[model samples]
Target: MLPNGDIVRQVLLGEKGVCETVSSDALVIDMSTIHPLQTDALIRELQEKGINMMDAPVGRTSVNAIDGTLLILAGGTDEQIARARPILMCMGNELVEAGGPGMGIRVKLINNYMSIALNALSSEAAVLCESLGLNLDVGAIKVMSGTAAGKGHFTTTWPGKVLKGDLSPAFMVDLALKDLRIAVDVARKTGAPLNMGIAAESYYAAASQDGKGRQDWSALLNQVRQQAGL
Candidate 1:
């Protein structure tokens, strides 16, 4: 009963399926990543037949699964989730009760959106370095990773540097523009149009041509502020 969302719906609602087969004491847990709305509907359907269920989706590598270290995000009531904890713990090293009903899958979707976007952004950073004929070394990665573009980065930190007019080179304007150019090319090749990314690229290009190429990339924010009369 751990198929995808569509198949789960078909099996549960299909003729003489879970609705008919499940006893009053049965507590069926579904481990599928699906739309919250659909999970809501399924919950209602299951309630009609006195069958309890939980949306408990799992993530991490296949190796993690084999090692019983997957992270499980679950949605259900306190009692229901408590009942499922022993089983969940056996399959995962971490288990989060993401709230009631469809909340688990909803959280997963939001997490997926950020992770997906970050991957592209990360790739863009690498491509930018390549285009600038810069070496993609560990220190470069650390610098980029320290910005808002990666983990352990702080938006406040970058903004602080810019506001204080600290234009020292953690990364330079020409380098930033080069990365954005490669990011744009990557997006185009993947049939993904990057509207804001392209605009940022333009800003960095202008800054570079204005003899700011050697300055910190964050200095481009100053250029933007000047244009806006800020």
Candidate 2:
């Protein structure tokens, strides 16, 4: 985030003053991935000068860049996306219009959270498999590949939320906490030990307590990242 913030300062506010020459007709699309709040600040600054901006952060890696098949998660108005679409198409194969300014980064953070968390989960599972002396290739890989956690792509539609960068709740943290608490209670009564469900209850409860009661459940993924020290 520091490096990203430095990029803004150097490019937009530095003595070289690139933004100073921006025409009123210019649409300044910031393709760098940075904090949503920082994007808001940039938007405000550019607005005074009559030059609009879009927060269109690049997705995928350097290899994709070389082939011009990068995915750009853009946050701006429909008009903005339409205006920039042709230019974007030249550099990227996909132009995902996420939402207004800040939305792209929000989506990116949530997507990144899942990626980081899942990688950690997989690494830990791999260690367990190694310690237990299981057949790492077939036993572990094939088993996981067949499970819900691995193959539940269409069954679990997190992309609808994560890609939109919309954290507005279809299921609020408070409601999720209440439901999880009830689930834990039912498990206790039935003598069913829901180990993972119990852990999730703690996460939901903590998120609710943090004033994210009205936020999307994935917003709690930030807490997961923090707890994992990532």
RMSD vs true structure, all candidates: 8.0, 9.1
Each model's total of backbone clashes = 1, 0
lDDT of 1 by residue, 75-149 (tens): 899988999999989999999889997778887887777677767766665665665567877535867666565
When summed lDDT is taken over every stretch of 10 residues in candidate 1, the lowest stretch is 148-157
Worst 10 residues of 2 by lDDT: 153-162
Candidate 2 TM-score to native: 0.67
Q: For model 2, how does the per-residue alpha-carbon lDDT over 1-230 read when each residue is reduced to its tens digit?
A: 13495688578867766687767798878777677788888888888777788877877878988899988888888888889889888788998879986677777767777677677666655555565567778656889887645764334435656346777887777887887787567656655555666677888887777787898766777666666887
Best by lDDT: 1
- Cα lDDT listed for each candidate: 0.78, 0.74
TM-scores, all candidates, are 0.67, 0.67
